[model samples]
Target: MIGPATPEGTLFEGRVHHMSIERLLAFSGGPFTLNHWPARNLHIDPEKAAEAGFPAPVASGLQAQGHIIRLLIDLLGDAWSRTGSFHSRFRRPVFAGDSIQAKARLAARRAEAGVTQYTFDVWCERHDGEIAVVGTAACTVHEPNPGVQAA
Candidate 1:
């Protein structure tokens, strides 16, 4: 089942399908271990990250994207896996202890062949409210988009 569509010209449009995630991976801001590639220019290794100009070990961008995928799926439905797409930009590094929240707002919608495609403004924000990642998400489903003109 698809989620509700945000109507144009309404304040509740964005909230109709609102979603939030408190924390993901929620680890203490400390050193991590990866046997295969120890301190080899990766986020899990502080020394390598420092050498690469990063203050500390940084989480993987894919990890952040995974959170987004979950948010989009929850906002839409299980059907998202088949037609969902994401365009993301890594804006900041996620430290080990920094909490991450996934948030999304409905952006636009349109109809195609038979499925409706919905676009969303999505991002991963740190606990401090800084955006660590920003992107747009699209999910195509069979549900009709109410209060939206399929263009």
Candidate 2:
């Protein structure tokens, strides 16, 4: 299990985290696909995907974002859920059979209002070395309170 983060600038510099592969499959009522027939270009039919100029059915941009979030959660645990914020742009289309992973590096840090906040540069890249998504994330890792009793 991962431990709590160190001081603001002491952790995650040049660090890399890889997410597990997820196969993009057609779901009958999936998010973004609900009541949208044209959205089938995401998974149901490869021919339709090719006709739309993609080599295969493309995964949703949210999938790539989920991978990046998973990486952050694994590294920061509940701290990320409580205080993490991210913004991402989809750079390239991710196909159904593509393998992808998330990577991150510590970009900066600061102490504000008794919290140590960290910022990271994060991205999701396909196995072919193409970047599918890029983003920045900021999170606060709170310090443990010392259990000092009054004398």
Candidate 3:
């Protein structure tokens, strides 16, 4: 969703980021081999991962967090990205090949020193009805960046 159409307590739910070995590697900055993935180094068993519905080793929790953060930044613009800090509790393991969705509901909004501060309850849920991560995040929207303006 775009800016808050409703007053202060607006909410937004984002689309899912489908997980895959290739997608994980791309997020890692290259086409990484299975041997290079963190799960490999941790001695994660391929058979066990397969039973967990993963085709191969899963991406790290931090990697998934980065994906969600990027998604939020894209929606909220530079304000949230520049000043926001996201912390989450990993409730369940997100395996490779599992589709996950990042959702945020505005918990509160207030004005302070001319800045609009917004708080949200954010979470990522697996397709299997498991919540992989949940947390509260807050961001302050500042004046638009000089380099780029929102169209």
Candidate 4:
């Protein structure tokens, strides 16, 4: 079993990491997309995208979530290997040219039997300071000892 993510109420705050065109393209593992994603690709060029008032093609909502997940996993390490679930709601659009950041707040923790459960407040925001996503997450840390109790 995996160990606990942290002692609970342990805040995990991080700054946004900018993703460039090349970086985003690499991370996505595909060609650039101009559409709303998961369905269509309007194929809007940079000029048209700018003319339309958006700095660039809007990024897929999933991409932002993936970035946040990567950040959490990097920080928590193996604790998330098999003991956590993430849920988020997209609140705004993120353009490919925009930078973004993720922040998480440890809200609570509970111990039962041998497992420790943790709840957190999670969110992602764009470089322009727009909140693109907000949600909560739950994770179970491995018991301190499968055979021992906290005496």
Which structure among the candidates has the greatest lDDT?
A: 2
Model 4 residue pairs with clashes: 16-101
**All candidates: TM-score:** 0.68, 0.70, 0.72, 0.69
- Please write out the lDDT profile of model 1 over residues 11-52, one tens digit for every residue: 111111111111222222233454442334445666867888
Q: For candidate 3, write residues 56-97 as lDDT tens digits.
A: 666667766765676567556777757787779878777668
**Least lDDT summed over 10 consecutive residues: which range in candidate 1?**
11-20
- Candidate 2 lDDT over 58-85, as tens digits, reads 7778877787887777666678877899
Clash totals for all candidate models: 1, 0, 0, 1
Q: Give the TM-score of candidate 4.
A: 0.69
Cα error of candidate 4 at position 3, Å: 8.4
Rank the candidate models, highest lDDT first.
2, 4, 3, 1
- With a 3 Å backbone cut-off (N, CA, C), the pairs that clash in candidate 1 are 29-97
Candidate 1 Cα errors over 4 Å, as ranges: 1-39, 111-114, 144-151
Give the whole-model CA lDDT for all candidates, comma-separated: 0.62, 0.66, 0.65, 0.65
Candidate 3 local Cα displacement, residue 37, angstroms: 8.9
CA error at residue 142 for candidate 1, angstroms: 1.2
For residue 117, give model 2's deviation from the true position in Å.
0.4
